[model samples]
Target: MPTSASAFEIQSDFDAIDFAGGMIAEAKRRTGDNAAIEYACADMFDWLARFPEAYDCILTVGTLHHVDLTSALRAMSRALKPGGRLLVLDLVRRPGWRYVLINSIVWDAPASFVDGVNQIS
Candidate 1:
């Protein structure tokens, strides 16, 4: 369930679906309320399935590094209609023993070893 669709699009155009809460809110606040401004506080995966063929270009940036990337992406792919475009930008890292060690050290950075405080806290 991999997807190329995104909420944070790189390009702004007529085909772009601005799937962002912060942007939507900022627009309303700055522009003094425009009626054409459409916004939703919804999950991306759930939203895609609801409107399969409504969009053409999709963009997702820097999300896979946070949560269950596989499950989220799979659902997004299914949501897309045929020929729809998707773009995914994430901090891709090699999965290995070395990766695990480096992440353990830097994820709780400024201290190489945190006296197991990283594990406990």
Candidate 2:
């Protein structure tokens, strides 16, 4: 990411938008006001569907599991230019003992931590 590049950060959840907005503000502040990022509270599907082939790259972190994965991928692909890159970082479910172990550990976790985990799961 360049200091002069234009970026859009859109989140379907309103609460998540505040976090993104704060991060962008902090980045701009640290970089002496050169980072150009726009934040929005909107559904990714609806927003991405409007801008066909408009973006050179699309990046999604820890968000895909919350919605319809197939549709989300299609929308993201449609919104990107030819040969554009799509970067995704998210959690995947583990089966058997791994799942059991994770559930056991989370059972004893702090209330706040467990709440966060539940939201993502």
Candidate 3:
């Protein structure tokens, strides 16, 4: 099962759901699968509560930053079946010596400067 806090508009072979009505419509138009995508515009915590230890895998990208980190982690942990895998892709800032040095040097820079630095690959 695929889930998203926001809407998705891509076709896929597996099941998918999101918390947006517009996304649901887009999925209906774009998806080729016979099974209709199920969706709900509800809070993640409440939605997740419906399924306990039900999923074999959970994948999230760039979503954890928008919610309570501890609570989200707990919810995901509870929702996963035994031996389930949870994969996450998101940005994180670590406080280390290098980070401290960079912050000290650039903390006073203008927003444009910071953006420019971040744009570097």
Candidate 4:
């Protein structure tokens, strides 16, 4: 498995996702030589751009919310090899005025701001 991120510190945010330093080390220890694990601390888009269609699978968890959905998805698609799979686990918001307002405030944007939801499907 190959993992990419902007940082690998075992801190609050990273720890919550189980991708922090300690977790990665523990996983590596458990897997031993049977698994080939690679980690890179680089911008996802830049990394994907440099290695077009290089990966068999790309897994993203709780990350798209913070990025430009269209751009990120496009990059991920380009980075995927033929018959590749992209598994994304993310939070979904219900469609409504209240939810929109909440998302705007939580994300620090306008009430009409849409992030990736409209772009999908």
Candidate 5:
């Protein structure tokens, strides 16, 4: 990973933003590096639309499925600088009970946590 880069994390949910803040803090504490990271509680489309070609990279996790994929991708493309990267991690399939149970056991996660993974779609 590059030693220095600007990162913006956008999420409309306050809880998700809070969780990300905690994770960022933990990461900084462990790595002992102060990375430039900005957290914005805004709808992804609105934020991206405001920053045309402003971001070096755009990444979304478990979010695109909830919106119009084509529009979302276009917005991301506009937001990213030339040669910038876009990475998206989303649910490709709805998890069955068996898959959920196995994931819960393998990750040592609670039933609720596993269930929430199902909602990503």
Candidate 6:
């Protein structure tokens, strides 16, 4: 775990999505003998499809709220090797007061939208 943390780092950037390495042009900067880091630009969904093993550790901050949580977590599970650790701290279904507070913000959405939110929760 500590081995990969400081030795090398990969950071991805995309206009459409925030992720690791993106295009030939940008990745070219980090490739060849001059390459200090490998740059890859690919979607997480597609990327995970290519790797069937688990990761040593997966870190997600508040980002998972953008996608359907179940699907995302399943994908993460698929990519994770056995005993892989996935650490995530994101939005949660708040019971009582917090739930009411969040509902208030989405009150303007159509009823079906509200239902969809509930389903996702």
62-82 per-residue lDDT for model 4 (tens digits): 666666666776787776676
* Residue range 12-110, candidate 2, lDDT tens digits: 221112234566466456656332455555677777877887766666666655665556666777776766666666655755442342333212222
Q: How close is candidate 3 to the true structure, as a TM-score?
A: 0.54
How good is model 6 by TM-score?
A: 0.45
Model 3 root-mean-square deviation = 14.4
Higher-ranked by lDDT: 2 or 6: 2
Each prediction's whole-model lDDT (CA): 0.49, 0.53, 0.56, 0.56, 0.52, 0.51
TM-score-better candidate, 3 vs 5? 3
Local accuracy of candidate 5 as per-residue lDDT tens digits, 3-102: 5444444432211122345654664566564244454456777777787877655556666546665566667777766666665555545454533322
What TM-score does prediction 4 earn?
Answer: 0.51
lDDT per residue for candidate 6 within 32-100, as digits (tens), equals 544343344656677677776635555555545556555666676676666666656565565554334
TM-score of 5: 0.50
Pairs clashing within candidate 5: none
Steric clashes per prediction: 6, 0, 0, 0, 0, 11
Cα displacement (angstroms), candidate 5, residue 51, comes to 0.6
Clashes of 4: 0
Q: For residue 29, what is the lDDT in candidate 6?
A: 49
- C-alpha lDDT of residue 98 in model 6: 34
lDDT of 3 at 35: 65
In candidate 3, stretches whose alpha carbon ends up further than 4 angstroms from where it belongs are: 1-15, 91-121
